[model samples]
Target: MDQSFSGSIRWAGDNSKCLDVQGGSPLVGAHVGLWACRADHPNQQFAWTEGDGRIRWLTYPSLCLTAAAPGLPIQLDLCDSPTAPFDAAAHGTKAICTSEGVCMTVQDTEAALMLMMLGLGSCFLMMTPLSAFWRVTAAADAHDARLGRRLGWEQPGLMLMMLVFLAMVLMDINFCPHLGREQLQLMLMMLGVLVIVMLLMMPLMMLMMFVFHGALGVNGCG
Candidate 1:
C-alpha cells in the first residue's frame, strides 16, 4: 500500500457505525463488529504493519482483520489477507478494508446509464420549479377558480418527485462498495436539500395564494 492509514474502518451496510474488534481476542474466527466505538478505544483502531497484508487490531497485536471466504463473516484471526506494505510518505487511506480480490463491478453501460439518469433528473428538477412559477404567472394573467385547488395537489407531487429522484440516486450507486464518510455525508446533504425544499414548498404555495388573492380579489383557502 502507498497510503498511510490512521482512522476507523466502517462497516459496509451501516454508515453510522464502524468496525470493532470482537472480544478483544487474538483467536481465529473470533467474530467482528461486537459494538460501536467507545471514545477511541484501542480495539476499534486499525493500522498497517510494514509487511502484513491485513489490517491488524492495535489492541491485540497478533490478530488481523480477516475474512477467509466471500460471503463469510469477517473476523480476527492469524493474518491471511494479502500483505499491504507501509509507506511513510503516502497520505491517502481507504476507510473500508476488505479481504484481497474484493471489489465492486460496475459495467460500462451501467456507468453511461447513471450519467443519463443524472442528466434527466437534473432537467426534471429544473423544470419543476419553473412549472410552479408558470402556474402563478398564468393564473395572474387569466384567473381560474380551479387553479388554486389544482395547486394544492402539487405538494404530494413534489414529494413523489423527491422520493423518485432519491431512489434513482440510490439505485445508481447500488452495488458500490467501500463508500466512506464523505460519500455518506454527501448523500445526507442531498436529502437535506430535498427536505428544505419540501419545507419551503408550503410557504411558497402560501405566497402564491396571497398573490392569487391580491391579483383576482379571491377569498378563502383553495
Candidate 2:
C-alpha cells in the first residue's frame, strides 16, 4: 500500500515545533514536524497506521503518542516521536481522504467554510453597532455649547479597535483545521468576548442613533 498525502503543517505552539496531521496519509507510524516555509526537513516525515479501527502515528517503535483527549484542552506535544496518533474512532469519525491531504473531504471543506463565514459575520455585526455608538458620541461631545461645537474625534482609539477587529476577521478566515485544542479554545474565547460586547452595545447604539438623528434634524432647520 504505497500512498502519500500532502497537507499544510499546523503547529501546536508558537515555535512551529509540533504539527497535527489534520488530513493526510493514514500511515500510523510516521514521524512529523514543520520544516522551513520551503525547506525540507526529515523531522517533517510521518507514518500513519490503522489499528482497532483507529489511525495513529508512530515515530519510534518503542514510543506511543497521544493527542489531547476530546473536549479536554491540552497543549499538543511538540517533541518529535513523542507519541502516536490517537484512535480516530475515539474522536468521532474519520474524514475521507483527498489528494490535498488525508481525511479532508469535500463536505468537510464546505462545513469549515460555513463556520468561518458565521464567525466572520458575527464579528462584522459586532463592529457595526460599536461604530454607530462612536459616531453619535463624537457628535454629542462636539455639540456641547462650552466646547465650541467641535467634534470630539478620538482617531487613535478608533484606529486601534478597528485594527483589532480586522485582525480577528483575518484569524477567522485563516483558521487551521489541524489546530490543537488549546488554540481552538482561545480563538473561540476571543470570539465569545466580541459577541458579548456587541450584543450589549446594540440597544445603546440604536438609542444614540435616534438622538443624533433628532439633533441633526433640529440643526438643519435652524
Question: Highest TM-score, which number?
Answer: 1
lDDT of each: 0.40, 0.29
lDDT string, candidate 2, 1-222, tens digits:
221221222221112222333232334433222322211322333333344221223332223223332222112243243332432221111221212122211112222211001111222222321111101111123222121111122322333544665574455435544545765565456555544543334454335434433433443321
TM-score of each: 0.36, 0.21
Model 1 ranges off by over 4 Å: 1-3, 80-100, 103-222
C-alpha-based local distance difference test score of model 2:
0.29
Candidate 2 ranges with C-alpha deviation above 4 Å: 1-40, 52-61, 71-222
Winner by lDDT:
1
